[model samples]
Target: MTSTIARPAPDATRRQDSAKPRRETRLRALDGLRLVAALMVAAYHYGGRGGAVTEAWGSSPKVQFPTLHAFFSYGCLGVQIFFVISGFVICMSGWGRPLRSFFASRASRLLPAYWAAVLLVTAVFALPVVAYEAVSPSDALVNLTMLQQPLGVDRVLGVCWTLWAEIRFYALFALCVVLPGANRRRVILFCALWMLAAAIAQGVDEPLLDLVLMPQYAPFFVGGIGLYLVHRDRRDAYAWGIVGVSWLIGQHYVVRELWRAPSPDAFSNRTSLGIVLVVTLGFVAVAAIALGWLNRLNWRWLTVAGALTYPFYLVHEHLGWVVIHALHRGLGLASAETFVLTVVSMLLLAWLLHRCVEKPLTPRLRAALSRTR
Candidate 1:
C-alpha cells in the first residue's frame, strides 16, 4: 500500500538556509591598501630617527628631510592596518579548515621565507663589514619562534618585531575559530570589548594585568573583523564613506600636525587614538573599494606592490643602511644625494627580492605542503 508522505514545514525548510552558497571574490582594494601600507612602512624606516644616515660616511650631514621624514614617521600606522587585514583575511580563509591543515598552511606561507631572512640577517651581523653587535642565542631562539616582541628583546631584523605581533594575533585568531559556535558577530563583539578595555588600561601606569590579556592594540584587528562582517553583509557604501573621512581627518590633524612637533613625546595619546581610528577606517575603505562598485579602480601596480610587500619590508631598511655606509665611505655624498640614492636602491632591491625569492618560494612551498597534507 502506498502511503502519503507529508511535506516538511516551510519553517523547517527555512532553517536549512545556512547551506546557501557563500560569496568568494577577491577585493583589489585590499591589494591597494596593502601596497600603500607597505610603502609607508618602508618610508618610515627610510626616513625616521633610526633611519638617519650615520657618521661613518665622511662629512655628509644626516638627511633629515622635513616632509619625507614626517610622512615616514606615520608608517607605524601601516603596521596597524596590516594587523586588521590579517585578522579579517585569516578568519575568512581558515574559517572551517581542520586545525592542523590551517596551521600548516600558515606556517608554510610564513616560515620558510622568514627563516631565510633570519639566517641572512644573522650572517650580516656576523660579518665584520656590517659592524653590528652579535645576537645572543636566546634572542635568536626567541626571534625564530616569533616570540621576541613579547619578551622585549631588541628586534632581530629591526622591523621583525611587528612580525612577532602578527604571529601572536594569528594564534589568538585560530584559537577563537576552534571555539564552539564562534560566529562572525561573536568575534566582533569580543574584539570590541577588548579594544575598550585596552583603551582604558593604556592610561594606567601599572595595570594589574599585563598588556597581552587586554592587548589595547587589539581593537585594530577587531576593526578588520568588523570590516569582514560589513563586507559579508554587502554594506559597501557606509563602510567606505566612514573609512575615507576618518583617514583624511586623522592624517591631516594628528599625524601631519600635532604629532610632528619637536618633542618626541608630543601628542602620544592623541596619536594613539588617531592611529586606531585611521587604521580601522582605512580597512573599511579598502574593503569597500575592493568589493563595491569601484572595482574598476583596482590598479595593477598596487597589486604588484602588495605581492612583494613582505620581502620589501624585510629588506628595505637594511638596504638603506648599507647604502648610507657605502656612500659615506666611497662618494662623500650630501644628505640629499644620500637620500636619493637610498630611495632608488631600496626600490631596486625590493623588486629583485620579489623576483628571486618571494614569488618563487610562495607557490612552490604551498604546493609542496599541500601534497604533504
Candidate 2:
C-alpha cells in the first residue's frame, strides 16, 4: 500500500522533452520523398541504366515499354536523395542523445529490419538464377555482419553497399555526437572538416583517402545537414558556406560521373552527359524541401508510402528480378507483363515485410536493447 513510482531525473526529462520539436519537424513531405526515392530505385533496377538485364528484357516485342524505361532511366538519382535525407534524419535523431544512446537507437532501428531483409533475400535466391551454388559458410558469416565488402568479401545483396556508406556516416557523426558544446555547431564543424579532408585527399592524388573520406557522396550528406541547421533557425554565413561547398562538390561529382559514363554511339557524349546533368536536379529538389520550399507536401497517402520505403527498398531489386526472369522464362509472359507483375508482387511483399517484420519487431527489439543498457 506504500509504494512510490520513480520518475526520470530532471535533466533526463528535459532531454526527452526537448527532443519533441526535433520529432515535430518530421515532415510528411520527406516521407513522400523517401517513397519516391524507393520507387525510383526499384524502377532503375527494372529498366534503367544500372540494370544489366534490361537489354534482354527490352529485346522482346511483347515487353518493350520504351516510355516507361525512359522515365526510369534517371532513377539512380534517387540514391542521392536518400543520402541527403539520411543526413537530415540522422542529425535529428542524434540531436540530444549521448553517444551510446544515439548508437543504440540507430542500431535498434536499422539492424532487425535489415537482418529480416537479408533472410528474405537469401530465401528468394535460394534456388539460384543459374544452377544452384551453395552459399559458403564464410560468405554467410560476412553477410550476417553486413560488413562483407569492407572486409573484402562479396555482399549478400548488391544494394547493401549503400548500407556501408550509411555505416560510415553514422560512425563519423558519432564523433561529433560525443563532442562537447552545441550539437548544431559541432555538426557544422564536422561537415567543414570532412569536406576539407576530402579536398586535401583529392589534391594529394591519394584515392584511398578519397575512399575513406567519401568525397563523392559527402556533398549530399553535408548539404542535408546544412539544410537541417537552416531549418532549425541556426543558419548563418558559416552554414551557408558549408552548404555552398557541398552543392559545388555535388555538382562536380555529377559531372565526373557523366564524363566517365560510357557514351552510346547513337548519341553524342555531350548530349548523354547533359541528360544526366538534368537528372541531378534531384539533389536540388531535396535541398529545396529541406529549406521549406516544398512545405505544402502533406499528403497522407504519401506518408504511408514513406513508411513503406525501407521495406520496399530492401525487398525490391533482386527479388523483383527473380520474378521477372521466372515469368519471362517459365510462364512465357511478355517483358511488359512480367515487369508489371514483378512490381506488383514486390509491393505486396514490401507491405508484408513492413507489417510482419518491421512493425512487430522494431519496438520490441528497441525495448530489449534498452534493457541491455
Candidate 3:
C-alpha cells in the first residue's frame, strides 16, 4: 500500500513564509481606533454641521450645538482615518493569503451588514415619512450590489459612497498585490505605482483615472501600506520613504480639496491646517502603532467596539436622520436631547445588528464563499 501527500515547491513555501510578522494577528488598538472613527462619523452626521436632513433639527445644527458643532466640522475627516486604517489592515490581512481567500474574507465581512442596511433603509424610507429622497426597489437592488456609485444608481443609504471607495481599494489590492501572493516587494511596488498613477491622474485631470486611482484618497491608503511594511521591518528606510511621500501628497490633496470640492457652509471656514492636521495625525497614529509606540492599547473591550463599527457605519446616516427628524420634530424633543438620544439609539441598533445578523452570518458566508470554485 502506498499514500501520497501533496506539497508545495520549496520556493513557493518560502514565498508563503516570507512575511516576517504574524500577519493574521489582531491589533487591539486598531479596533479601538476603528470604534473611534465610527463614532466621529456618527458625531459628524448627528451633531456636527447639523443640517444633514435640512431642518431635521428644526433649526441650524450650528445654532443648536454651537461650540461642539465647530469642532465636529472636522469629524468628516474620520473617513480619511478609516481609509488609512483600511490600507494597513487590508495589507496585513491579505499578506500570504490567496486571492480567493482574501475575497471570501472581505465579502464575508462586508456583505452581511451591508445587505441588511440596504434593505432596511429601503423599507424604512418606503413609508414616505422622511424628507429625504425615497429609495425605490430598483435603487435598493442596485445598492445591494454595492456598485451603485459607479453605476450611477442612487444609494439607499447615503454612506454607501464610502463603501464604493473601500471595495475599489480591496479590488485593487486583490488584483494587483494579493493575486500575486502579497509580500514585501509586491506591496512596495503596489504603493509606489499607485502614487505615480495618482499624480498623473490629478495632473492630467483624467476623470477615469481619477475615478480608478482615487487621486484624492490614494495617499492615505498608500501611507497605510507603507506603515504595514514598516511594521514588518522589510526595509525601514524604504518603508519610511513611502510613508513620508504618502503624507506629503496627502497634505497637498487636503489643501487642494478646498478648491476642488467646496464643503457645506458650516465647514467652509474651518482652517485648511485643521483638515491637514487631522489627516496627518491619522498617519502619525497608525505609524506610532506600527512602530510599537502604542502597544499598551490592548484593552479587551475594544474588540467589541470594533465589531460594531461596520454595522454602526452602515445603518447610521439615514436612519439617524429619521430618528433626529422624529425626536426633534415629531416628539418635540430639544435639539441637544435629540442628538444624545439619536446617537445612543444608533449604537443600540448597531449592537443588535452586530449581534443578530453580522455575528451569525459572517462565518456561514465565509464558509459558503470558501466552497466556491
Candidate 3 residues lying further than 4 Å off, grouped into runs, are 1-24, 259-268
Local lDDT at 256 for model 3: 72
For model 3, how big is the CA root-mean-square deviation?
Answer: 5.9
Clashing pairs in 3: none
* Candidate 3 C-alpha error for residue 273, in Å: 1.3
lDDT of 1 by residue, 74-108 (tens): 66677767766776677566655555656767876
Ranking of all predicted structures according to TM-score, beginning with the best and ending with the worst = 3, 2, 1
Question: What are the lDDT figures for the candidates, one per model?
Answer: 0.59, 0.70, 0.83
The lDDT, on a scale of 0 to 1, for candidate 3 is 0.83
Model 3 scores a TM of 0.91
**Sliding window of 10 residues with minimal summed lDDT for model 3:** 1-10
Which of the numbered candidates is closest to the native, going by highest lDDT? Answer: 3
Candidate 2's residue-wise lDDT over 181-204, tens digit each?
Answer: 226557778888988887788789
Model 1: ten consecutive residues of lowest lDDT: 13-22
How far off is residue 373 in model 1, in Å? 7.7
lDDT of 3 by residue, 1-373 (tens): 0013344587875665464335345688888888888888888887676446556777777777877876776777889889999999999889878877899999999999999988888888878666776767787898888889888887888788888899889999999998877876788889999999989998999899989999989998989989988876634678889999999988788777742344565343567777788888888888878876777888888888889889989988889989988988899998779888998898899899999999899999999998866
